[model samples]
Target: METATPFKLLLVDDDPQILLGLEKIISSHFSGDEILIFSCKNGLMASQLLASEPINAVITDIKMPLFSGIDLLKFMNEQNLACSSIVLSGYDDFNLVKNAMRLGASDYLLKPVDEGLLINALYELKKQSGQLPSFTRQTYSLTSILKMQQLLEGLIGSSDISLPDADDFEQEHHISGQTSCLMCYVDIRRALYSNYLTMFQFLTDRVESFLNSSREIPLLNPTVVYGRLDTYWIFLLFTDEASFEPEKILEPFLALLTKDHFKYSFTTAWYPYAHIRQADEECRKGFEKYYFDLPYAPSDAPANWQTLSESLDAAAAAAAAYDYASTIKNLELCFAMFNFLSPSISDVRKEMHHFVYSILNRNSAFIPIISTSKFTDYDLFEHIEKSESLSVLKKHLYSSVNYLIGELIESMENKDDYVIQKAKEYIHNNYQDNLTLNDVATHVFLSENYFSTLFSQKTGTTFRNYLRSFRIEKAKELLTTTNLRIYEVAQQTGYNEHSHFVRAFKAITGQSPGDYRQMKK
Candidate 1:
């Protein structure tokens, strides 16, 4: 068996006895690797020492004489250090613990820490740090996050980023295992960028601290990844298959944030375990569901992310099938309904931004034509607050939706026929269950035979052929891209019989399901 890398430890305290005590306890409890202990009376000395040496982990006292632990934490943040930190303080220093957490300390222990607790914290940190052989005292900077944000901004109007190809992401990210959930939060109002940044920083700080403090449930430290588009943040938490309930862990933190800070309201969405690399796509789906399909008000009840997702998926498909005039008319009704149902401009804006972002992000036909310039310009709340006439607001809503629909139509004209677009939409809406071309044609008010002929004429394929192609495409996606079994794929893509699915798979690709798996290998 191969031995894991040793963790480099840095113990900081003003008192020699306390430092010696920690050294003794850590030496006895953790003997597999070398422990580097740094005795510093103040934060300034610790900062200087950190500047000169590599410290994997830092254990410091909160109430040191000169430079305090909080002061060192601020320095760490400014310096772009990634080392995990533990704060050692008196029991009465609850406020200090909060401050340390806000500054990104991984965990904190009371003075005269228990031997077991100290060892547990160290062990947890070791697991999180991965292959880091030693702890390096370093500074933390927001440069990487800023760079990622910039990259996201660049994707705002690009077509290639549409709905993100899950297979492409798996190949790029090199993800090999299952992920428990994909979590995401989006700030609809662009003006709140600064506030969003602060909230994100706070969330990262608190989550890191919480994970470091707990030894029983070891979780993979989450990373900030780009999502379907540039407007959201994604985190992929790899948890045990049997022990995942991400909502339970996330709710308290969300509640604290909403209650403590009254300036802005927040909405959250989550997707259950799927492929780890498809995290961005799942998060995008979550954002669309929460922001578009669900009600905007904060509720005591948890949002049903799966239901919202299904609804939005259906709505998007329906919207895509409308003729130019019908499309405009439907959007008008949607906006009118929105105007009547939503109580405030803030709520309306949130809903509209979500709806528009989701539709624009998923449909490549709409993105290039919709003016990115105006998406951020209008303040719906300002209009709602100033105008008393419902007529004016209704008109504004109509125009906004109309503009979006027009952009969609214009983009689609160059890429696909109207019937083909409608057929694509139908496939998307019914992809999860048993569906047939005749069923789709009936829904669209066309004769089964006539619709099939038209679909084949417009799309260069028979309706049944198209349905098979679509199902096969989705099945191929599950096979190469997800861990879901062949039977599950069959069920998910509308085929009920496992043997039927296998025969169809072989007929289309000239390979058995097992053979396809081996080919992928």
Candidate 2:
């Protein structure tokens, strides 16, 4: 007798209350041990759980923040994850429900969900659970594509490390010796919303599914390698038993990718298979021709790109130091280099994003204010992407830089004023003590020299003068309010010597202490 498979159901909604209620309703129908229940507040969480766990079904809301239920369904479809989906939608989201269905959602329920209908859907999903494919999450030692590329490049550069034979990879893909091979390079312009790894995985699965199902070519699975700049290098190996043209496969593959016309633009280059590493090198050179080298690419493009990167780095450092002039100068230099290079539009957008991200990351004070002012990192990148030309991007960058610098200056001033106010309060409360600038500066966590300069800037008076004037004001108040002896008043007002107090008081009020007392009376 075969063991029964444990049914795992995931409930996804942005509403905590809805998730709890759904869990309760599902729990009432099935025992906890027999049917495992999981809950998440967004589609992102659901996708993660579905990827790692054996989730039999997902009950996800059609709309949510960050990642929508439709996006989750698409992710499952893209990853070829074997889980049934039942989407929850509002009455107005019929179109979204239709999209979810198209993306392999088994069923859907309207909001204020009917418990009976949900139970029915679960029962149907449970019956078909055994048919769902088992999934093992692919593990990677390093998740970042850039890091992986760097590591591979380093290994390739090292004298001791040896590159693997082409036959080795071909044998791993189950193709024998001297097999015909075609290397396909697919470059997609990365979207602002998706991370590189997720995009790469989706493309990989989509390509594998398409190529694996082809009937014309006696094909082994393609050896997929992640490449630089949102590109994939796929090596398709064919058995010696077949005679097929590479274009037959390449043309349809390109067509399949071009279907995502809005989110991605496809640039593909194919070549006869050579050494694995050499194939990548050739593909990169070919891709550079298509992706980076534009009609306007001049002879000095490499030098210009180098200068642009260095200038952006200098600008980031200048921004961190709050040197607005140097920051602007370096940024203008970057723009000049960038325009002179006249790289591809994608390169322009990508470089500007790095420029903005670098500056903001270095000067973190600009991040929150810029974010609150509706110029978030996402918005910034979107603006750069949408710019028709370098001039438009330059204008946007300058406007944003100016706004952030203004905010940074105002923020510094306000903070300094606050610290100065605190210092004033401390002096007012402890004026009778012999408080020096060092003592008060330490209390406020600032160096004495900096505090002195800031005090003068914010209060419009020197620290020593401000203290003397404050003490004198206190003394004059006491001279009229209480008839204490002059020496006693001096002692109470942060002054040790009576003669010095009298001199300071005359300097400020233009009268001797005794005369000031009489004048006030």
Candidate 3:
């Protein structure tokens, strides 16, 4: 096996400060390695460097002035530079990141980038270049998350888990808990699933800032950021009394969210778990209501035309975010708004027709509730009016909208399945080469992280594990049939180092290659 060339990294950002900050953070991780790091203010300079220098990877910002990151990505593709790219994206720039992903960006890191994340991206690019992976802060973060989630979830039984002693809780939880605690779970509406880390940090800062300024509200201790899953934030609030109601914290939180004008709709609920014995009950019983109970109060009286229209519009926007939960929840709010009007069955039916039509306009291809041409006529409304009761009308409307959600999910699934299958085919046809996950992900036009996740979801095995299994299987067939040295067999099956191949083979097969070969003979 040959040692790989030293890694060369190109950093491009319109902001000089950002470029310097990112380079300083990333370079610290590779101080002992033979790696070259270069920084430029725009993509044009990065492009020039790409043409003249041996750059193994690039970290570029998306919204540069003269030569944007997207433009640079396009140039890289057209000229086939083959450098792995990591796009620096903002929350609003997700659409652009999607386009960049399709244009072969290896992965993306969000703006106000975390130091660990930058190092992790560079370390990952290094691995894809056939170099040994190094320990990175990103690695530590991921490892810590796994350990924390495991310990926290394990401390409580599936049935019981809310309260532990303050001393033990503070020690085990890694933070101080208020004598009275409110555990608030917040789910952001319309946040991209891939932006988990950024969302976590953003929510953390937002909540902390609000807590800091709002002292008038009876809060004993500062808000503590609890652990997070992919897109949700779990926060804990402390109060002076053990019998404190969670709504005290939740109400103020909601008020602050409204005041701040957050773009995403959020569902927030807090559980009171101050009593040690009731901890399990609070967590287990309240979880259902927390997730499914209507976040907004139900209405019976007539809602104004403006309010109904606004609710419907909000639901439509939720659909665009691909937030099916929020869409349905908003639709439920809309239905409540409609029923509050105490309008005639005919009036409700009329409004339903308009609402459904609005939703279908965006998803007409996925939901076939009506023909595109038929949307102009009143025939669909007449059919809907035939429903005998409000109960029946609500059921009909719910099922239909659910079908739309199902269709939307399925449409995306089909496209994802096609991409994963293509990737699998590519891996199969080229298993003998020194292939990297980035190469396959790049070939299939997906960000490496997304490709890995989608592939695992579809196949129930990770890309690396799947590739290793395939390669080892190929090596087995060759060892049995052909007169080849073990090292040659290892190379043909994509292992660059003989010892690494032997270790992997034994791990998978429970036998050395030589022993397996002798047994076959």
The most accurate candidate by lDDT is 2
Model 2 segments beyond 4 Å from truth?
1-179, 185-205, 212-214, 217-235, 238-245, 261-274, 285-341, 344-521
In model 1, the runs with Cα more than 4 Å from the true position are 1-354, 372-395, 406-416
User: For each candidate, what TM-score against the reference?
Assistant: 0.33, 0.33, 0.32
TM-score of 3: 0.32
lDDT of 3: 0.65
Query: Which 10 successive residues of model 1 have the least lDDT summed?
Result: 260-269
lDDT of 2 by residue, 137-174 (tens): 45333346555455344322323454454334445666
Question: lDDT, candidate 3, residue 319?
Answer: 60
lDDT of each: 0.58, 0.67, 0.65
Candidate 1 structure quality by residue, lDDT tens digits, 1-521? 97655666777788889888988887876564545455676789889988887778899999887888999988888998877899986634768888998988877776656564576567667767774344442223467556545444332223344334444444454433453454444432221222344435544543454445544544554433432234334333434342535555554544533433211212233333333324444444443222223223323322343333344344554444543355444444444454334444455555545655566666655555555524332333343343323444444444544555655666554543555666677687687777877788877677888888878778788877777877888888888988888898899888999998898888899998878977997
Prediction 2 TM-score vs. true: 0.33
Sorted on lDDT, best first, the list reads 2, 3, 1
